[model samples]
Target: MIEEIQEQVAYYNARSQEYDEWFYRIGRYDRGLELNQCWFNEVDVLKSALQDIGEVNSILELACGTGIWTQELLKIGKEITALDASSEMIAINRKKLNDTKIVSYHQVDLFSWQPSKQYDLVFFSFWLSHVPPTQVDDFLAKVYRAVRPSGRVFIIDSCFEPSSTAKDHFFENENEIHQRRKLNNGQEYQIFKIYYQPNVLIDKLTQVGFQASVKQTNNYFIYAEGKKINKL
Candidate 1:
């Protein structure tokens, strides 16, 4: 599993240039690279996850592709450590947020890297879905450790409904995911085949000692927030 993830990372790194161009070109529309806000959930969902955070002195955005959510962190006046596995993605993000003082960018694997300091808010936007099911436990453990006492980890990613009759409801199979990809963006990039199962993720978070729950967003993404159990 580790090797598979590493291979996927290498592939993404190699195609970083192409991906950069592709997204930048798409920036012309609301969904484009001009900013990654459109890909995010509605303002209300973002607000809900952030409401209790009040103000953060420092925040960590793991696997922060192109730093879209990192920008949102900045709006709330939090200094951000935007970490990505692909150096090319970090480079593209840096190009967009040229101010280095506020946004400290790092290119490192989330599975192995350990933070020297805890953050008030640790966020992974549309990232958990990419992680393989077998490795999710370890991933959740790391996320649990990165956050400060009473701080929370916010995950917003793809989720499917079990009995939704909607046409583009939740993905139950590869075909549905492919259809979603085509509908959202005409790209068929499935570097690593992944699927989202909401209840399963919540259960894993519980096992890792987090207080977890899920929120259905925009009838598309699943937003889960987990709070690290702090020692009093």
Candidate 2:
């Protein structure tokens, strides 16, 4: 599993340059203007949801790839600690933020990294699904430790939507945790990809000592917000 996680990091490092193309609906990820509109609409729903949580004094973002959510965090957070396994991704993120001083970037494998400090808010987007099933509890525990008392967590991820991928990609099986992903250059990598049902995830978070609520958009995304209610 560690080897698989390392490979996943390498894949993201290699994919960093073209990562925004998927988010911006360009090149291979352009499904159509209609689908693109739906994507952004769902993204807006997520943004609004995040805003509803009120302001955060400090935020810690895990797997802050390409700074998509990092940019959003800056609007509401006074300071942010962004962490990712790929230095290339952090480099692109730093470039996009124009070298913001308020945000500090750390390149470390999340599986082995421990938080030396806590924050009022913890955010991770499209990242939880990448966690292997065997490590979900440990990962959530790490997230729990990263949050200060009375702090909250917000997470966004995919919802098993077929249209969520590039036009050339296909979901080979419905019941698998490992998925094959391809880059525009015809490079391929196997990465952990697990789609969780909202209720199941809510229960899991609750079991891990979070007061959690998970909801889905009209399509394309599922988001959850939870407050730390007690120590795990």
Relative to the unseen true structure, what is the Cα RMSD of model 1?
A: 5.9
Residue 206 error, candidate 2, Å? 0.5
Q: State the lDDT of candidate 1 residue by residue for 167-191, as single tens digits.
A: 2334466423222221233333234
lDDT of model number 2: 0.90
Give the CA lDDT, 0 to 100, for residue 100 in model 2.
100
Model 2 compared with the native: what TM-score? Answer: 0.97
Cα lDDT listed for each candidate:
0.66, 0.90
After superposing candidate 1, which stretches have Cα over 4 Å from the reference? 14-44, 47-52, 160-190
**Local error of candidate 1 at residue 174 (angstroms):** 5.4
Span of ten consecutive residues with least summed lDDT in model 2: 166-175
Model 2, C-alpha of 110: deviation from truth (Å)? 0.3
Question: Using lDDT as the measure, which candidate wins?
Answer: 2
What tens-digit string does per-residue lDDT give for candidate 2 at 138-212?
Answer: 989888889999899899999887788887779966569988889999999999999989998998888877899
